[model samples]
Target: MKWYGASQRRGTLSRLAPDGKDVKAVTLYTHTFFLIEDGRSDEQKQPHYTAVGATPEEAEAMAFAVYQRAMDCNHAMQQKGPMLIECSHCGIQRRVLLPPAPPVAVTRKAERRFFNLF
Candidate 1:
């Protein structure tokens, strides 16, 4: 499937300081696994997976494990799209060309056609 609004993967700019300063870290109450959704809206990406942790490190480790497990099974994955990764309290965008899922399987039923001639 094609992802829409690819440019809005990052967080909003208003959250930054007025003096054009970037904050290094933000307070995290609980570690969460959020999927960098495919959209260009002015909204933060929500967590799609059910993985959660008490700390950022723990959550990240779990996310990595999930990634590895997925890659292990998706042997037919194609290296085409850029995978967006979001860490705890950080809005830095990384451009890593990770392999996407395999193409969907399309099966059609075969129908026999009969023709009558005089």
Candidate 2:
């Protein structure tokens, strides 16, 4: 994504390719995984991953690390601050993107179109 007037990926800033084209990384991605207690069995609660990394893989690793560390004491619940990571390529580091906010309703039933259902 564009950041600070430069294209970036996984914390790395875009650099001019030999052909003068900007090199970009893969699109940032995220995944949801249920976090159970560090051990096995009996716990009915599962927490979903809420972290974003430069890449989906990175996001998972980072989020898991945070959860494991914060819950080291066997607490059932824990809160974590935003995770910050640096890119090895360009040093442009940042917190993962926050979850999108709910959209506001601007109009309701202005015109019910039959095709809209499809």
Candidate 3:
């Protein structure tokens, strides 16, 4: 997905999900699960998941951390700033503050459609 400009001073920025639909911001949050096997029942436990922040500062920190961790092994990390991260569980959306001047584009190419197959 292409990144857009920074959020509007802690406001909800409409973003398209991987499916190319207008999904709520909260849908971006990813959840980490822990397996807990009990004697009788097996259950999955989730301690914490990544989430966007209400303020620019908080959003920036979260986005930076995510970027750093993802590219730590490769050593090819790009700086980022306030971004919108969605909550995987609750479907809550928030503005995550990131580094200053995050890589984002103001516009994107229009989506192409294919006709019926022959």
Among these predictions, the greatest lDDT belongs to: 2
Worst 10 residues of 2 by lDDT: 1-10
lDDT digits (tens) for residues 3-115 of candidate 3? 23211112344445554565545422332221122332222221122435655556656654543343223323232324644444333233345558767878988866676
Worst 10 residues of 1 by lDDT: 5-14
RMSD of each: 16.9, 16.1, 22.3
lDDT of 2 at 51: 54
Each candidate: what lDDT? 0.38, 0.42, 0.37
lDDT of 2 by residue, 62-118 (tens): 655544554343433322435444333322223344568899888776776798783
- Best of the two (1, 2) by TM-score: 2
Query: What TM-score fits each model?
Result: 0.25, 0.29, 0.22
Looking at model 2, the pairs that clash are none
In angstroms, the error of model 3 at 39 is: 51
Stretches > 4 Å off in candidate 2: 1-26, 37-45, 76-118
Please give the lDDT score at residue 18 for candidate 1: 39
When summed lDDT is taken over every stretch of 10 residues in candidate 3, the lowest stretch is 1-10
Candidate 1 Cα errors over 4 Å, as ranges: 1-50, 75-118
lDDT of 2 at 7: 19
